[model samples]
Target: MAAPLTDAGEFESWLNDRLDSLEVDREVYGVYILGILQEEESDEEKEDALQGILSAFLDEDTMEDVCKQIIKQWTECCSRSAAKRDAEDAEVQAIASMIEKQAQIVVKQKEVSEESKKRKEALLAQYANVTDEEDEAEEEEQTSGNNFTGNDKSLFKNTNVEEVLNRQKQKRDQAREDAQKKKEMDKMQREKDKLAKQDRKEKEKKRTQKGERKR
Candidate 1:
């Protein structure tokens, strides 16, 4: 008598404990629990208990189908969440790379501007020096006394003026040439800088692509 009572109480208590630990699929467990509780207190009760236990624990054919469905849905949800997180991380990384590229461009542009300013200052200084030299030469010619024959006087005057004009023209031409050379050199340097920057950008792009491939 005690052994039969113990067996009945054991099944009932086990069912109650497992039902309390439920998270989902509550309807299935509810139907089984009710079926067990309503069974007669005889061999019928034992048979019902066995049937309910088989339904709850022996999940080989019918319950295996439900578990497969639950696992499939759970796997899909986890995969979708992981993919969304990965996409967001990639977007943030792209934005950060763009910001770095723009910063490099700005730095290169500032360096070019500074170089141009320095070149202009150098040209202005050279022009000022040439102008001062010309003024000094003109003053010396005007201070020289007139002591010569008529033809000699006329030749000296015309030659002196021509020499001064020619010297001034030569100075102007030299200044122009120097400024032009500086501008051309600066242009070439800027082009080289641009090329180097482009190379760096290409390398960074390759690195980013490699990282994505690894992922």
Candidate 2:
């Protein structure tokens, strides 16, 4: 069965304290105790295992007499480990800060790129509008030029346009004069016909009165 996990903080603190108090020979006992702490099957077993390991170290006269040397060596090892941990933590923080700065720069670059794209799009739209207007104006000019060409062609269609126009004006004047003379002649003819009818009636009445006088 696996041993219960130790809290890193608690274990580091306990190890630091034990290392500070250890004598040279007591270090062997401390190492054994740490091993037992790592391997004990249960939390309850760890205390008993630590006592057993300590008892084995104290029984030996050589370790018991070298307590001061053990303490110095243990303290030095623990200090080295602490320094290494501090350096690693500093490195991690530095890398994290670099990553954050890079991310911020990327975000700013994207924003600038987007703004540039928008400006370019606006300019493109303006350019397109201008091009469209120019095309429309060109088309209108072409249409007007075509209309002028058609009118010019029509004006030149009559080969003797100037002579024909003069002739038409003369004919129109002659027709007007003729029409006026005809209207005057028709009026005179109507008056003569009315007088002839009156004369005929008067002669017929005289002839009838003479005939009655003779009868």
- Leading candidate by TM-score: 2
lDDT of 2 by residue, 1-215 (tens): 64434344545455656545544243454456556555656544754554445555354454444333333343455466677777899999999999999999999999999999999999999999999999999987886776545666566555468879989999999999999999999999999999999999999999999999999
Question: How far is 68's C-alpha from truth in model 2 (Å)?
Answer: 3.4
Model 1 is weakest, by summed lDDT over 10 consecutive residues, at 1-10
Candidate 1, residue 146: how far the Cα is off, in Å:
8.6
Q: Give the best candidate by lDDT.
A: 2
- lDDT values, one for every candidate: 0.63, 0.67
C-alpha positional error of residue 47 in candidate 2 after TM-score superposition, expressed in Å:
18
Collision count of model 1: 0
lDDT of 1 at 19: 49
| Candidate 2 ranges with C-alpha deviation above 4 Å | 1-30, 33-65, 148-215
Backbone clash pairs for candidate 2 read: 22-71, 23-67, 23-70, 23-71, 24-67, 24-69, 24-70, 24-71, 25-66
* RMSD to true structure for each model, in Å: 45.0, 12.1
